[model samples]
Structures are given as structure tokens and as C-alpha cells.
Target: MNELKDKVALITGGTKGIGLGIAQALLSQGIHVAITSRSAKAAEETAKQLNSSATKARAIGVKADVRDFESQQNAVRLVLSEFKQLDFVIANAGLGHFASIEELTLEQWQDTIDTNLTGAFYTIKASVEALKKSKGYYISISSLAGANFFAKGAAYNASKFGLTGFTQAVMLDLRQHGVKVSTIMPGSVSTHFNGNEPDSSDDWKIQIEDIGELVVDLLKMNPRALPSKVEVRPTMPPSK
Candidate 1:
């Protein structure tokens, strides 16, 4: 879209899956995109794969662990150094752990919460000033698990639920500053998230590209309108 042309966008955990999809979508629209991964190799590889002369410029990828505040901050800095401005930040890096409450270890709970919730906070806090300067957007890739509880998902559910609340409050707090914030909660995406293998057989699951398309739509929307929350699901999930 014309609105996204020349804008700079950053996506965390964007080496593959949903994050990569979003990066690709933005790049196709002429947006300058930056992506972060835990590994420098993965980041470089993904950027190479997404780059094309047609996209105007290749996406930039940086090594960043979202759980580390300094790392998150550095990722934003790298983007700014390369692009000269940061217009959007997508806090899409997250993890999930599934276990019944009685069986869940404290370590497992902490890992989930730290990566999924606290990591998002770190990424946003690092980018807040840049976003405010550009009057940009902050999008969180949450999950339906944030609202719907399930067996063996106590830790994952808690992290997501807390994230949902956090996203809403941040949206309200940032709106006054002309920075838009929104959360996208998707269910059962066909991606390698949380170590799940994605195969062609998993056609019933939500496609990663769909989430990418949604983010592009959000960027194209008028500044007067803000869809602070969006919940998406596969129209026809396979029957058990």
C-alpha cells in the first residue's frame, strides 16, 4: 500500500514462520523491513531469502534475544542506523510451554513468562522512543491461548493472558502520544512455533501469510481508526 511505502518496520523472531511472513509482506509493499533472530546466521539467511531487487531494498536482520533488554535495544539501534528511522515495531518473538499446573516445573513457567511476556515488554520499551518520534505502530503477535484456557497449557495460557492485558493497557497509554498499538491473537497457526513441525498435511491450520496480510492491512488503515485488538482463527480446523 502507498501508506507503507518508504516506512521502516521491524519484526522480532523474524527468521522464520509468522515473523518472517510479516517481513516479507512489508518488504513487498516497499517498506524498509528489519528482522531480529536469536542467531546471527539465521537472521542473515532470512534476510537474504526475502531480499529482491523488486522490493527496492533488502531486509536487514540482526541477532537479538528478546529476553535480554540490551539485546532488544541494540536491535532497534541497528535498524535505525541502517534505515535512519523506525516506523513500526512488531513484538512477535515468543515461546510456549504446555504442562498441567500440578506437573509444571517452576523453570518451565518462568521460561514461558519470560520469553512470551517479559520479552515483549523489553522489545517495546526499547522501541518506544523511536516509535513516538515517528508516530508509528506497535503490533504484538499474541495468541488465542491468551483468552481460551486448555489442559496442559497452564504456563502458556498464563503468559498469553497477561500479554493480552498488557497490550491493551499499552495501547491506551501510547494512543495519546500519536503512537498506535495493537495486538493480533491467532489460533493454531501452521508454523514451527514451540517446536511444532509444520507440514502440508496441516492445511486446516492458519497460514503464516494470512497473519502477514493482516499486518499490512493494519498499516494501511487510516490514522483516525485504530483496531486495537484482532482475533483470528482457521475457519475450518480439522476434527479430532
Candidate 2:
């Protein structure tokens, strides 16, 4: 882990929940982190929290709409300006709008794809050059929905499934350049995703911190070993 100290990472949609969780874990490893949110204020607030005196690592906040190529490019530039070299880029920004195919509006479906799928594309395109120079890692926070579709999850499922395939294709393209790419698909995480509050009863679900720890482990893995896709689930959960 000490080998990773002073490295840098940029996380998209990093203000709250899983993104923030990953930021915290990276900071703990002495990695400089730049976390982005659509809101400048929220991004700055969380960056400050992560860089508190106790942990006291370099952290920056940037406002970027991953849905836009220009915005994502600006974010990549900001991270380069702050940290010089980027060792990891996490395409963790996402959204979910659940509705049956007939019930889903065109706008809702478009927003989900734009945010959850195209956003990852924009982010990777913006960062790939820098990642190549650093021989870094690219990890996308895909979800179980990427593989399992539900009755009311047409928009969300389609976006994630596309994202899953997109990341895999990217992995094959970037690996020759010494950059590693992977996607993490998590199930039933105790997070604020989809605006759902996590209560005590949600403890049986995977914790956001658990995902963070998994990311750290991935980063620490031997460079020759790559777990290109990971599906995480709670060890014990209420039966279906």
C-alpha cells in the first residue's frame, strides 16, 4: 500500500454515497484525490471533509457534468493541474430512473442512458490519454442491474447493461497501453442511490465502505493480475 502513496485518482459523482466512500478509502491510502459533482458547492464540501486534519491528504473538488464531453475534459484538466499524474480514474457517477418500457418517458430513458452510460464514455475519453501516460487503472461503478433486469427497471437496466459492455470493450483496448480497466457490479448496497435512505434494517446489504475497500484491494493487486469484472454481494441476506 505504501507503494501507492502520493499517487492520484479522480472520481466522478463523488460527493455522496459510493463515490464519496471510494474517495475516503483512497485518501486513507495517501493518494491525492479529486472528486467531482455536478454541484461545485457539494463537491467542495465533500472534498474538505475528506481532507480533514486527521487524514490530511491532498484533495480537490471539481464540478463537472459527466454527460458533457467538455465538462469531463475540464475535469480531467483540473486533476492534471492539481496532481500532475493520475493513477486511477473512477467513472462512478450515475443515475437511476425505473419504469416499465411503456411507462418510461423518452426523457427519463434518455437521462438514464446519458448519465449512466454516455457519462462513462465521456469520462474515459477525457482521461484515457493521461491514464496511458501513467499506466493507470480505470474502474467503473456499474451495478447488478447491468446483468439482471427487473420489471420496472427498463431504463436503468438498459443503461447499466450497456455500460458493462462498454467498460469491457474499453478494457481490451487500453490494456495494451498498460492501463487496467475493470467494472464493479454490486448488489443491494446500503446507499442513498435512487434517493432511498439506508436504515438499520439495510445492514444486511453490502455497505458503501465495503465497496471502497474492494477498490483499494483492486488497486493493491499485483499489476499482472487483473480482475476485470467483480460482482459483489452480501454474504448473508434475506432470501428472495
Candidate 3:
């Protein structure tokens, strides 16, 4: 715990699942966190739930769609206005569409790529100036699909693969400017991703909190050391 007290963090898609988990983790560490989602109502509700009378005020939630550059830019502006300085950003807004290449519609492919890959680009691009000013950190939430393709996952696999490459390149580009970049690739997290209810059957999946804890760990690492990339998976899964 490198004492994240007073540090400001901006998380996209922070209203639920992995993003929410990460926001909660940062809040527990006394970090001033601001989260964004497409829905204004959801964001406000999540912020209320995460807020505390102690620990540097809870979190601020804003409405921003990752697929839109203007929306992401507005999110950055909101973070800067609320926190005065931005220390870290997590681009966690994404969607998965699973379909074989032959079965995938052109719209489906574009939607997945736009939301998962280009969305991250919008998020990071909008926040770069603030990050540079604070020598901050950028963490992209990737997935195992980024490297290991699965059946009927053409769209998802392509997006994650592109994201992984993009994250690495950004890491190299930002390091010299004092901004650290890293990607967290998690395997089968038990989240309500793709609009499914999270259930006990998903126990074999990595818990959302597991990813949150990893993010906390990354933030606490010494500035001189950058992990660059992390790949996480459950030690054991249910027998198929």
C-alpha cells in the first residue's frame, strides 16, 4: 500500500463489474476517484454507493461513452475540474461480441472494434495531457483473448489483439514523458460483461475484485519500476 491518499484516478465503465471493483479498491485506499459510464443515472448511483464520510470523499461519477471522442474528452475535463490533477486512468469500457467470422455481421465487427479498441484510444488520448502533467499512469483492461483466440470470437479476439498491441506501443511512447502505461490481461473474470447476470456458476472465473486488487498493486509499485504488462488467470477452474 504505497498510500494512494489524495491521488486522483479516473476509471471508464466504472459503474459496474471490473471498473466498479477497481473504483471501490481505490476508494478504500483513500484515493480521490472519478468514474465514467454511458448512463448518467448509473454513474450517480454507483458514486453514492462507493462514497464514504471518511477517506478523502468517495468518488465522482460522470456520463461518457467511450465510443465517442467528444464524450471521453468531456470526461477528462470533468476529472480535471473535480480533482484539480489526474494521477491515473483505467480504460475499462468494453464490450464483447462472439461470432465466427462467417457468421459475424459487418456491424457487429465494427461495434466490437469501436467499443473495445478504439474506445480505449479515445480515453487515453483525451487524458494524455493531464497524465503528462502529473507523470501519471495509464492502464488498459485487456483480456486473454488478446493473445489466445477462441472459437466464434473473431470480433472479440481482433479487438483485444489490437488493444494489446496498442497498449504496448503507448507504453513505449509515454515512458519518456514520465507517464507510465501498462495493460492488465485477465482470463474469464466473473463479471456481468456482455449483459449477462453474474452467478455462482461463475465461481471458477476470476473474481472482479481480483482484477481490482491487481490494479491497486500496480499503482503501489515504485515509480522506477514498471511492470509494463500483466497476465492473470484463475489457478483452477471447474472441470469441463
Candidate 4:
């Protein structure tokens, strides 16, 4: 039997892209998963697809918005009610709005910060107790933009930077409880973010499954070692 068999995970914004990829990977490793989305239809359909592909493990859909604390609390409650234990939580819901600082609207900036930064805060807060019980893991999907700044990326950069710092601090706060925390910072991922539809041209970028594999590796590592933060990038990119 798989050592991770029957472990459970809750993934925020898991209806598509990176979140969906991680759900699939965990299910394959015999982990039950609850995937949340703001859209009820997308969450349910994606869960159905994952269930069909998985062998022993199961998947469920939850309609939750990470930006709202109550909604995140409800998601964690529902997962614990169904799975009886929570072993991992991945904060993967995020968005980017690119424009010059002067052109960035207040609404865009707020949405970016709320969804990418505050949302992660809510996710971990909601799930922390459950994780402490299971000695589980928490992983946030941040980005390379957290460390690198560029014009027209004000909102995105701010959110990711804040998320990276937040996860590190939380790691210190939770390590004594036997819970592990880490943030994944990926560069040039081929996901449908920032209104960019994935296509063949994105082949050189990091695939969602690649991130999925990385999450699995982190979970499977020995408990004595903690990779507090990880930065991932495509091996090669078309030269400028």
C-alpha cells in the first residue's frame, strides 16, 4: 500500500490549472482531496473527473472563496467532516492584474491583494488546527514575481511578495506543533492566469503537472527535514 494512502488534503481554487494538477497528483498517491472553487459547477465537475481517474482515493468539491474568512472556515469544516482528518492544505488560488502603476485601478489592486495574499492568510488560519492534529503540511503557491519587480506588475508583485513573507513567518510559528509550512515560487508557469489562455506556445513554460510533482515530493520528504521555501523555474526559456 502507498504510505500516503488515505491521507486527506484541501486545495483552494482547485477547479483548474495548478490547483487541479495538484489534486490529481495527490489522488494518484492515494490521498483523498477536497478541491474548492468559487464556482460550484467547476468544482463539482472537476471533482467528478478526478474521482473517475483515481483508484482508491476520492475527491470532493467545495464551493468556497478564500478571500472570505467564513467561507474558508466552512471549507475546512466540510473537509474534516467528510475525510475525518486533514493532512495537507495547499493555498493555490491567485490572480494577476498587469498595468502601469498609474493605470492600475483600485478594484484591481484590492482584488489581487485579497485573493493572492489575504486569501492565503485565511486558508492557513482556517486549517491550522486540523493540521496540528494531523501533523500535516501547508503549502502556498507563490511566484517568482515575489522576488523580482517589474513595471506593470505592481499588484501581482506586491501580493506574491507578501504571501512569501507570510508563509515563512507562519512556518516558524507552526513548526513546534509538528506542522510543516512551505511556499512554492514558480517562474513562467503555463497556467490560465493574467487572462492568458494556455496554448502550444507555452510548451517551454512550467507545466501544471510539474508543480504537482513538486508538491508530492515535498509531502513525501522525511519529517526531520523541512524545505521552508522552494523556487522553481523552467530549465530553458527562449532567449530574449
Candidate 5:
């Protein structure tokens, strides 16, 4: 925690869900954070909520659309201007568009691929230089669908699969620069993903804070080691 104090982290799609969870955890560790959302209102409101609970670190909000390369670039610039350094980049902005090939529309497919795959590329491209300078970490929130495909998940699966592979290749490319990169593939996380509301029924699913803790653990690991890729799921989900 002491080692992480005063460091800066940027989380995309951070108004809620896994990104917001990670932001909270980082701030609790005395790491300042900037959270981005497509809605300026959401970003600022979430940042205020984070600041209220912050102990030793501060929180700021930026409006950015990860699907746009220029938007991502501007976001990184804003963070750099405010924090003076970027120590961590969490590319957590992603969306799912699930449907069978026969039912999926071209718009749905494009949105999924653009937001989940190309968005991650834009995020890393925009922040890689800053990360290289700081020897920072880059983490992406992927999904188990990346590794295992299923019916009605064509668009979602393709996007996540691309994200997983992209993050791994990025890991190989950035390690020599001392910038760590990894992807977290989670299964059935209790978030408002795909319009499912979370409730007590979600108790058996992986929680956002759990992912946050995993990220913190990764950050605390010795520089000699890297987890590179992590696949996390509920230990005891109801039998299929």
C-alpha cells in the first residue's frame, strides 16, 4: 500500500461495475484515480462518490468514448495534466451484444467489436507511452466467453476473444519496456452487464470487488513475476 501511495490510475467505463470497483480499491490503497464514462454527468457524479469515501487519494472524472481513438487520446492527456503521471491504466470499457448469427444485426456486431476490441486497442495505444514512462501496469476486463463460445453469444464472444488475445500480445510487447499488461477473464460477474439487474440472486456469482482485489494483488506482486492472464469464476455456482 505504501508503495502504491500517490500513484495515479485511470479506469475507463468506470461509472460502475468492475471499473468502479477497481477505482475504489485503488483509492483505498492511497492511489489517485481518474474514471471515464461516455456521459459527463455520470463520470462526475461517480467521481464525487469516490471522493467522499477516499482516504488518502483523490478521484476525478473524464468524459471519454473508448471507441474513438481521438477521445481516448484526449482522456489520457487530461489525466496527465491533472496527475502529472500515469501509473496504471485499466481498459474496462466494454459492452456485450448477444445474439445468434441468424438474429444478430450488423449494428449489434459492429458495436460489440468496436467497443470491446477496438476500444481496448485505442486505450492501450493512447496510454502506452505514458505507461512506458512510468513502468506502469495495464489491465483489461475480458470475459470467459473469450475462451469458450456458446449459442447466442457470437458478437460478445468474438469481441472478448479478440480482447484476450490482444492483451496477451500487448503483454509480450510491453514487458521489455517495463510496462506490465494482463487481461482478466471473468465468468458471470454480478454487474448490470447486458441489462441484467443485480440482486441477492447474484450471491453465487463473482463480485466486482473480488476482481478489484485480484487487480490489487497483481499490482503488489514482485516485478520478477507477472500473472499475464487470469481466468476467474465462481467457486460454487449452481449446478448447470
Candidate 6:
């Protein structure tokens, strides 16, 4: 586990929600991190605050549009520039666009698929080489929706389901190279996802820090062990 410390990580959409939670958890473990967002200011501000914490783990905020391969590649470049090594990459930048097939717009469908699915591919393509060099870990924050279907969730379901399959397949392709890959699918996380602000009323939802701890634990697993896919749900949700 001592080897886990002092590693460098790059997380997409790390300015808030699950990404930020994961960053804090890793930083406390002495890992340097670079988090990206669509908004430059938000990313910079959040990075500044994290750096100010006594953890003393360096943090950098980068502006990136995960939907674009070049943007993701640039983020990778920035992370290497800062930390000189890449150890962990989290493809967490995702957005949901839910609507019935009849109501979903072309733009909405494209945006959802591009950001959640193809974006993950771009991240992996850009970082896999660096990760291979360090025998690093690649984790994607997926959703239970990848397996469960609901009405008016065509786009979101497609993206997550694709993500689950994509990450798993890549896991097989990369394991021999010594890079561990995993996907975390949470039932419902209390975060500012889909524009819903988390409140005390959201106690029933899975907390972001729980997901963060899960990531750290995965990193600490024995070299011979690989839990490629994880399913996490709230112990209890409001009784319905």
C-alpha cells in the first residue's frame, strides 16, 4: 500500500460531485490529482481549495470537454506536465439526458452518447499508454441504470450500458499489461448530478465519499486480485 501513495491521478468532471469526493479521498492519501471541468474558473477554484488543505497533495484544475478527444488528450498532457507520471485515470465526466424515444431530440441523444460513452473511449485512448507505463488503474464511474431500464431513459440507459460493456472489455485487453481496470456502478448517489442539489433529505442516497473510499480500496487490492466490476447500492432507501 505504500506504493499507492505519491501517485498522480487525473479525473474528468472533478470539480464537483463524485469526482471531487474521490479527489479529496485520494489527496488525503498523498496522491497528486488533476481534475477537469467545462468551466475553467470552477476547476481552478476547486483545485485551489483542495491544494490549500493540509493534505499538501498538489492539485491542478484543467478545462476540458470530455466529448472531444483532443480536449481529453490535452488534459492528459497537463497531468503529465505537472506530476511527471500518470497512475490513475477516472473517466467520470458524464451528463444525463432522459426522454422517451419519441421526445428525445437529436441533439440531446448525441450529447448524452458522446459525453458518457465515446468520451470514456477518448479518455482511455489518451491515457492508456501512460497508464501502461506505470501499471496504473483506470476506473469509470458508471450507474446501475446501465443494467436497469426505466421509461423515458433511452439515451441515459444506452450510454451507461455501453460504458459497462466498454470498461469490461478494456479490462480484459489491458490486464496482461499490468494495468487494472474497473467500473463502479452506484444505485443512486447524492450529488449535484442532473442539476439536483443534494440536501439532508438525500440521506437515503449513497454518499459520494462512500464511492471515493471504494476507489481507494480498489487501488489497494493485491496485485493478483482484480474486481473488474462493482455494484454498489444504498443499504436502504426511503421505504416506498
All candidates in order of lDDT, best leading? 4, 5, 6, 2, 3, 1
TM-score of each: 0.96, 0.97, 0.96, 0.98, 0.98, 0.98
For model 6, the superposed segments whose C-alpha errors exceed 4 Å read none
Q: What lDDT does the true structure give each of the candidates?
A: 0.90, 0.92, 0.91, 0.95, 0.94, 0.93
Off by over 4 Å in 4: none
If both were scored by lDDT, which would come out higher, candidate 2 or candidate 6?
6
Tens-digit lDDT string for candidate 5 (1-240): 228999999999999999988999999989999999999999999999999989899999999999999999999999999999999999999998777899999999999999999999999999999999999999999999999999999999999999999999999999999998999999989999889899999999999899999999988888878899999999999987
| Top candidate by lDDT | 4
Q: List model 6 lDDT by residue over 9-86, tens digit each.
A: 999999989999999989988889999999999999999999999364788999999999999999999889888999
Q: 1-240 in candidate 3: lDDT tens per residue?
A: 356889999999999999988998888788888889889999998888888443655699899999999999999998888879999999999998887789999999999999999999999999999999999999999999999988999999999999999999999999999999999999988988877788888888888888889999999999899999899998898777
Of 1 and 6, the candidate ahead on TM-score is 6
Q: Write out the backbone clash pairs for model 2.
A: none
C-alpha lDDT of residue 35 in model 4: 97
Q: How many backbone clashes does candidate 1 have?
A: 0
Consecutive 10-residue window with the lowest summed lDDT within model 4: 1-10
Q: Model 4, residue 22: displacement in angstroms?
A: 0.5
In model 6, the worst 10-residue window by lDDT is: 1-10
Pick out the ten consecutive residues of candidate 1 with the lowest summed lDDT.
52-61
lDDT of 2 by residue, 91-142 (tens): 9999888877788999998999999999999999999999999999999999
Candidate 4 lDDT tens digits, 1-240? 126889999999999999999999999899999999999999999999998889989999999999999999999999989989999999999988899988999999999999999999999999999999999999999999999999999999999999999999999999999999999999998988878899999999999999999999999999988999999999999999
Number of clashing pairs per prediction, in order:
0, 0, 0, 0, 0, 0
Lowest summed lDDT across 10 adjacent residues in model 5 is found at 1-10
TM-score of 5: 0.98
Report clash pairs, candidate 4.
none
